[model samples]
Target: MFGKKSRYYGLATVRNTDRQGRIVQAVKLRRLPAAGGVETVVTDGSQLDVMSEHQYRDGARFWHIADANSELEAGELVETTGRVINVPKR
Candidate 1:
């Protein structure tokens, strides 16, 4: 289950059998929206989850921030402190 603010939230899950013949329920990958957001400066020890909580009031929506910034991973986006990042509008 995903959080309310998650992009995958409310998306129907598809059940599929892997090579091992094990059933797995997965959400299809979706293309993220184009980057359009306000710029924000990251302070010391800033993390994506924390920025999400601050910008969107939901820490679980950190992926939104990463996607908006065209980052493949949240960790990569937040790896550097004092960097300018984009916080997407919900």
Candidate 2:
């Protein structure tokens, strides 16, 4: 038997950077939660835009918004909220 639980969503940042610069760089999108962060396509490995942006002041991680959806306008606020699903062994 198996059991599952519900989890809430919080703000996290997606860390990525533009494909420019001499040594490459990164930047923060600021105030994006875990779910929103996922939507964020952080190019950087850590998505820590270290070269282009700064870290959170209150110890919060970087975050990014989800990609554009036809249902959504040019800009809309969205988030990721759900329990962390654990993958079972095959």
Flag clash pairs in model 1: none
Minimum summed lDDT over a 10-residue window in model 1 is located at 70-79
- Model 2 has an lDDT value of 0.26
* Residue lDDT tens for model 1, 1-90: 799977679987888999999999988766766778888877778888888898889998887787777566678776777778888887
Q: Each candidate: how many clashes?
A: 0, 17
| Overall lDDT per candidate, in order of appearance | 0.81, 0.26
- Tens digit per residue, CA lDDT, model 2, 23-70: 532332343323321223233232222312342332122121111222
Listed per candidate, the RMSD to the true structure in angstroms reads 3.7, 18.1
lDDT for residue 73 in candidate 1, whole number 0-100: 64
- Give the CA lDDT, 0 to 100, for residue 3 in model 1: 98
Candidate number with greatest lDDT: 1
Q: After best superposition, candidate 2 residue 87: deviation in angstroms?
A: 36
lDDT of 1 at 54: 82
